[model samples]
Target: MARHEDRDPLNEEDLAQIADLPKVELHLHHEGAAPPAFIRGLAKEKSVNLSGVFREDGSYAYRDFVHFLSVYEAATQVLQTPRDYARLTTALLEECAANGVIYCETFLSPDFCGGGDLGAWREYLHAIREAADAAERDLGVTLRGVVTCIRHFGPEKSRPAARCAAETAGDWIVGFGMGGDENRGELNQFLYAFDMAREAGLKLTTHAGEWRGPSEVRSAVEDLRVARIGHGVRAIEDLALVDLLAETGVVLEVCPGSNVTLGVYPNLAKHPIAELRDRGVKVTVSTDDPPFFHTNMRREYFNLANAFQWDADVLRELTRNAADAAFCDDDTREKILKRLET
Candidate 1:
């Protein structure tokens, strides 16, 4: 029998081959997706002090997950209007297209975009949707929105975010979820907001089991009743909980590179994505925040292949899984799946 290996080194050609594969991403953040240079230019235009957000080498600088969240929000300070978000959406989707990503669902926060006002949120949504339409027409990459609540901001504040999301639930904004410090607020606290979005005909997902424990995953499922989970890799700690995830067919939008960068795991080999997949969990790969983690869709695929010896067939299976679990409508999903098939 062949001895199991944690990783297999790949040359540039191998990485290039992986880079050409069609991809789908189900976990990404709108503000967090901003390119470093883009944010820097905005900061320069506004004369904001973003010196703390970057390293000496001109990359995002943060000490840990909490600090990363701080930097992520800090970068949003420059993005203060509908036009700013429009530019951001266009640039982000174009980047995704360049990386061979055919479909991507990103988390957008009303807290940053509109300060939780429904009217203002509508304006921001209009700008974002216009950019998405342009990107789809020109770049052949479909972009969808998942309106996200900031968990650290508490449940009372999540109310307006949910209201904003509920008002705009449609073809572009197809789902609702939460991101931020997952350790804050009890799951039941956000139940009303989740229910509101769900009643408004939006699919549900939430960040869990990344910065917290398996119990958080249970709460996200039992209380919020999310159909998908963002970074539920920590569920592996609880065998029964892992079994529950498998039994329920709840998709995990696993961002292995982000997990390692955030110290959720020491490194790629220590990440539980492959193990969770082997246990029947529907796991899909994404770059939660590409620039912040210094990763892209191509890097994600290449690293996963290197770490797990996953061949083209395995990578395609993961892409198909993302398409199956995407928040888009059936027509969009079918289109993306057809691209993956070819």
Candidate 2:
């Protein structure tokens, strides 16, 4: 990690410039990014009770990581139809655009979309894509999906989700991944599902090493053979694994705010994102679940600048890293790179 004393501290103007830089976010959750007000309005219209889901001030509330999952699910209960998801895409993209995100790849779960049914998943996907298209035209932010299966749902459930991803593998749905409670299952258990997605030509990523240790990241790389690992900061605990990640050109979707909010690290200053980058690991910044963490792309950039004293050059490098790691096709990648240059 770059030490504070090793570089000149950024002034307020430099921080402002860093925050305004165009960003590419490779790790985001679809439902988890729902703004609290949107969810509240949906719940009101649907007559769903979301008593414990939000705090008095209207932010999502939870006692711990496990409880947060339950709260997240409760909040998502009202978004039952494809139309609801379309509205969500619009709201989320507006936020991303406000934060100067030019390109984003979000994790979309078949489980939440339609209970892992391919036919139903397709309906939900179409609605989302339509909204995404509008958002791209109106908000100047591009969106793509990575079909993700909840890890705690078990390997059997993941099969149907993977099948959905394979069936819909195309320009819009470009990747397949796993996200959920890391403690509940081993990475190797999802091997069959990953292989299925790979056969369909979808890129791969999996959440690992956030709650667990370096071995989990190793398993994600070796057993699952993922090109990216979400929140792989724990790999810093094992230097050899870190070196391996750098050598193999694997990307780490490091969500500093989420990690800090969830107590994965005490604070951003202590986070391993800079260290991972400095060690040659391909690290990128993102707000995994922005609303849940009370963060966005702008806040992430500003905090990282203060924590690491990273200037505009380093921040732009991270954006380039995210662009290189994005699962979009070449044409879209070229467009995003062009936007960044401006």
Candidate 3:
């Protein structure tokens, strides 16, 4: 990563231009992106107690990554019905639009939606899609879903989640992925589920190299055959593996804020996103769970600008990278690309 002393600081005008630059984000977590206020409101309406999920200031509170998962799931408890998810879709998109995100693909776990039941997953999907469609029209921000399986839930549970993903594979639900506790299970253990998704024509991506080493990212590519790896920044530890990722065009959905907030790195200066991009790897910026990290797309651009001295042009290229890597169909991809150009 570039040092702060290496380049001139951005002025207010430069910062404003960078902030207004349209963005494309591909690694967002649907439930994880919920606004604290929205979650609290829903919890009240449902009469569900989410006492420890938030801090005194009302932000999601947790000590570590493992604890964050618990808090995230706890906040999700109030989103029990399809109607609740619909509201969530609108709320998150409004947040995205405010941050200048023109296109975003969020991870939606079937386990969270309906406990991996195929029939019930459809109801949740329909409700979310209806809300997404309305958001596109009203907010001008496109939303798509990537059905994810929770790794800690084990591979047997992944089977039903994969079934739900395969059943819903279409224009909106464009990909199948696994997220959660990358430390819990090996990537190969989920191969059967990944294979099922692939057979149904869903794109693949997996959470790897976040808590693990380069070997885990290698497994995600060689074993799961994913075209993208979520938080694959740790691949930087092995120069050879980094070269391989660049050569194979496996895009890294790098979330700098999430990494720093979760203590993956001490700070952005120690992060490897700039190095990975410099080495010819396809890298895109995103907020894995924005509010949890107290970040938004605009803030991501600003921090990267300050950390690496990135200007509007550099930020635009990163947004373009996300557009190219997105799981959306060709038509939607073109639309996003055209928006980026403007």
Candidate 4:
């Protein structure tokens, strides 16, 4: 496993110990998980150029957050068809299973899959759903989709995405969320979209307190009314906000490796995940986009253990927290928790 230079690195034996710890992942991106080699292959097939997306070592390359977003979208250019999405789904689930992620809810965008056309969205969803079903059967990794809208696309464009999400609320299409450039639009402007998803009975979450501050997270819960905050770790900056999050029981999908890799914090020791947890806030760990961040579920567990001196019990608590926060149905959640118990 690759380690960030400033942090104390884990050896092979340390990584091997956490390899089979069953986990639930709640904040992964569909397009972002595309293997670099897979994207390169698709770019070749479509005759598209992705020179800017890869590094000399054949891994993703980007200098900072804004450029990372550009590179992420650039990689998505290869995923132009429903079948393409199905292939991506299969590859992602296989990687998740290998990392001991039994249940994973990934953000899938209508804009990317079908360009906000409901009919086309259904076709793409069906392809991805079929792939997920096969993966659960063969790989033992249960998959769920959170239909997400790109926040940077603005409110007008977000409506079609919300409509698509609202129309597909079900066991497989479990939640609705917004994930993109968080700094682009005012949170209130997206309230109507969240309302649409809420009316359709979709669980809500949004990216906030990541590139921005605690006020961004505060507004997401207050105006947008999300049950979960993607990367709300920055809430640690405000003790009162931390208290409020604890009081309200809003879960934060904390992604440490992504934070440190993006320079959100200097290192895991400085990251706010442990502080947030200590403050009585509901916190669960996930690798926001594993490969892009150079992490997987096992690595996430290993790093947390090393940084916080967490034992097996602490790791299990995180798994249980994730299973509880999972967007799946009650029966599915029960089954997952039962697995964790065993």
Candidate 5:
């Protein structure tokens, strides 16, 4: 086994070299990662009530993990029109493209798209997808959508979210999952939603092993049958679970920076990514909410290189993991992997 890896916690120059490697982000949230300046501008333009969502630096300010969600939603409330989402998507893809992201799958909640309704969801999805097309033309990054239900809102609301997902399943919206306050309920509560997406030919993924425990991961695997897991860092708690993940060939969308930022682990040193990788578990790196977590793909690579001593090869392999797990059709995935070869 390759024990002496390259992405350690000090190789800034090496980190710089790998920072430009083509990347595939599998866990970013559409609403949670808006630039603070963008949100503040929208709030002011609309005369909305957003008093203290920002720092004196005009960046986002949040007290804790839960508070982070409130600030995320507060920032989202100002985006009242399809144009807002379209512009946001355009700008976000530009930033992501700058960071060498060639392929991205971001979480899009119907509640935010249309507040749990079908017609409104279609309008919002169409506008944002148009922006995706424009962004692709300009930035050379393909953006795929994942319709996820906020789990904390309970299972009933998830039904409509899944319905919207089923209605929207096509070339752009290719997957579905769940991401919300982790303590909301058991994985079984959202099984129907996942099943719905899966039956609609959508690939599946779910946020597990974050605030919850390995039991949650177990439940997610057992009940949701997800193809990939979001965060999934907490699965380290059960050694058997780790082996099971490895054997099952399930991918873990690991976001080290997000975990540290949310206080899931004290720092990257304590992160379970290296261990999971060494154990043959396929773990890919991503920035779950880049700006909100004060990170980007470039910074995430730098941090991982510093923490895990990852070299360009390792970063390349991580990109492969993401590409392999991506919901893009096989032809697109092949194209992405070919581009990453450079």
Candidate 6:
């Protein structure tokens, strides 16, 4: 391996130690999370123009934040129907199982599932639920979903997205969230959408503090009533916000590699996950878009261990933390905990 720069955060031996540990992933995106080979083949079958999305080696060619969106859309085009989503869900779970993921909560978009029609969204949801069931039975990995609206499309679109989420809230689709192009927008703009999901008894979480700063996390908690905040590490920059998150017991799903790869943090050592944890924040690990970020659950565990010198006990706490923060009911949570114990 080539010697890293002066800022190298981890040595090679550090990475090898944590690769075999079991883990739970809570912040992954469905489209952006696909394994590169799986996505490439899907595009090939559909003859989709994915040239700009992936290089010849099957790695995503993301230039920056803007180009990442275009590439994500291109990959998403192949998943046009229920079966496509079903297959994608199953495939993701299989990869997760191989990487020792016991449970995962994926973000699903109603925008792609016919853009808010309750009737069509049900079909799309059924496929995802069925795929989750199959993956659980076949691979012993449990999966759930969080229905989300593409925030860039404006909150007007979220009413339908929220409606679909409300009508279909159940065993697998246990939560609601928002993803896509939402770095600068205010959380109150989408309050109605969160209100609908809340009334449906669905748990809520939202992306915040990734591109923005600590104030973004405050807005999400204040307006959206989120139980968790995705990439909320920037809260570390603001003492009051950090205290609020810790006092209120809000979980932070921090993605170390994703933050580093996307320039959210200068480097892994500069990442605040460890600092947040030291300050009593409930933090867990995940890969937001595994293939796009060149990450997987095993790799995330390894990277975190390398960065923080976490041992097996710390990794186990991470999984238990995910279970506690999961939207599943008591029965499902028990089942997952049993697996984690063994």
How accurate locally is residue 151 in candidate 4, as Cα lDDT from 0 to 100?
88
Off by over 4 Å in 5: 5-13
Q: In what order do the candidates fall by TM-score, top score first?
A: 2, 3, 5, 1, 4, 6
lDDT of each residue in 96-203, candidate 4, tens digit only: 998889999999999999899999999999999999999999999999999999988899888999999999999899899999898898889988889999999999
Q: Candidate 5's residue-wise lDDT over 1-342, tens digit each?
A: 455463245455665678678888998998876888788888889999887788898888899988988888888989998899998998789889988899999899999988978999999999999999988888899999999999878999999999999999988999999998998888897778888899999999999999999999988888888889998889999999999999998999999999998899999999999899999999998899888888998888877776777787777888899999999899888999889887
lDDT of 2 by residue, 161-279 (tens): 99999999999899999999999979899999999999999999999999999999999999999999999999999999999999999999999999999999998888988888888
Query: After TM-score superposition, what is the CA distance of residue 45 in candidate 2 from its true location, in Å?
Result: 0.3
TM-score, every prediction: 0.96, 0.98, 0.97, 0.95, 0.97, 0.93
Worst 10 residues of 2 by lDDT: 1-10
* Top model number, TM-score: 2
lDDT of 6 by residue, 182-263 (tens): 6646788999999999999999999888888888899988888899988898899898888888999999988999999989
RMSD of 6: 4.2
**Whole-model lDDT values for every prediction:** 0.90, 0.94, 0.93, 0.90, 0.88, 0.83
Comparing 1 and 6 on TM-score, the stronger one: 1
Top-lDDT candidate index:
2
Between candidates 1 and 2, name the one with more favorable lDDT: 2
Give the least accurate 10-residue stretch of model 6, judged by summed lDDT.
1-10
| Worst 10 contiguous positions by lDDT, candidate 1 | 1-10
Comparing 2 and 3 by TM-score, which wins?
Answer: 2
TM-score (C-alpha, index-matched) for candidate 3: 0.97
1-342, model 3: which lDDT tens digit per residue? 453356677888889899789999999999999999999999899899999999999999999999999999899999999999999999999999999999999999989998888888999999999999999999999999999999999999999999999988999999999999999979999999999999999999999999999999999999999999999999999999999999999999999999999999999999999889889899999999998999998888899999988878778888888999999999999999888888
Better of 2 and 3 by lDDT: 2
